[model samples]
Target: MTETNDTANLIQEAEYFYQKIFAAPVPRPILEKYIAANRKKMPRPDERIRNLVLKKADIEAVEMAWRFKSPRNVLTKKIHILIYLAETTPENFSLFFNTKNKRFSSFIVLAGHFVRSMGKFLKGKFLLKRYNLV
Candidate 1:
């Protein structure tokens, strides 16, 4: 029984680590947009064109429009999010980009985990002292 429990715990830990390596956390505001779109049943592509013909399109000045969310959604939202984050917060672009590339992203996440574990052992001191970043 104890061995079974240990194996289950290990499997859960591995699953969590896998998600941490591949997927990045979606922030609240962007998530809200998807939720709202889902709730409102936003107009379909054809309807959007009709609205344009009548000169009543939402955000007429903008080219790309928002989309409704569904269970089988594509990577469009993910790319949009990455682009938005990269533009707004250029410093963290590498982290955003890594989430797109499997190999590089895995390395970045593992390095982050290693640094965090080391920080705890070093009494919350600098994770990388050689950088001299206070």
Candidate 2:
């Protein structure tokens, strides 16, 4: 029972992530239909079912082709911190890589540096103006 619930949750999370990467609309109604019926089963693609993913084989092929880990894997914990600071969208995150590699990590670092510099500049300007009045 516990494993069933855990699998269901994993399927739900995977579907959500798939929605982010895919251009197709989510098959929420179809997923809900299966979830309601079995309550303990994950959705397996069938002709009648509206599969949110492209296909199982397609996903497997991509996984096999790119077995390499993401460059920012080292900063997994700080990733959220960087993402929160960056103005980038999820759609563009994968495309962020350049010839140098780890573009998103570089972008996050550059963004943090720029923000800190901008803050310092603003504070200096404010202090200069506020000194005579204060």
Candidate 3:
């Protein structure tokens, strides 16, 4: 039983490391847009669009996380998240585009790509410096 638990932890740790190597934590609301879309029991018309409905859906349950949580998500929003997975090294991409003041108006919504990437970058840099790795 202990070994089984250890194996589970190892798997989770590997995934966590993979995610760090990929990008950052996704926001809660963005993940829900996906779950509500997939689950057969559709939220009510009014409940569907409410941010709170999406927020309550567990963010970590978003599948293929390394795909959706990486720099690739920022590039194409993950229609091809896996196609770019093996190449997701930070040196090969950037979330900090030169669009400091950029803005767009759209009726559509995108998932957690942005916040996840940015948060990952910031956290990685902080951890590196904190440990004198930099």
Quick one: ranking by TM-score, best first? 3, 2, 1
Per-model clash counts, in order, read 0, 0, 0
Ranking by lDDT: 2, 1, 3
Worst 10 contiguous positions by lDDT, candidate 2:
45-54
RMSD of 1: 22.8
List per-prediction Cα lDDT, in the order shown: 0.36, 0.38, 0.35
Candidate 1 local Cα displacement, residue 47, angstroms = 56
Off by over 4 Å in 1: 24-134
Q: How close is candidate 1 to the true structure, as a TM-score?
A: 0.20
Per-residue lDDT of candidate 3, residues 26-110 (tens digit): 3233333333332223222222112212233222322233333453422123223322433343444444233354344221223
TM-score of each: 0.20, 0.21, 0.22
Winner by TM-score between candidate 3 and candidate 2: 3
lDDT (tens digit, per residue) of candidate 1 on 1-134:
35454334333322332233335454444444433442244222232222332342222111211222132222233334334533455555565455454887788978997876554435323321322212
lDDT, candidate 2, at 37:
37
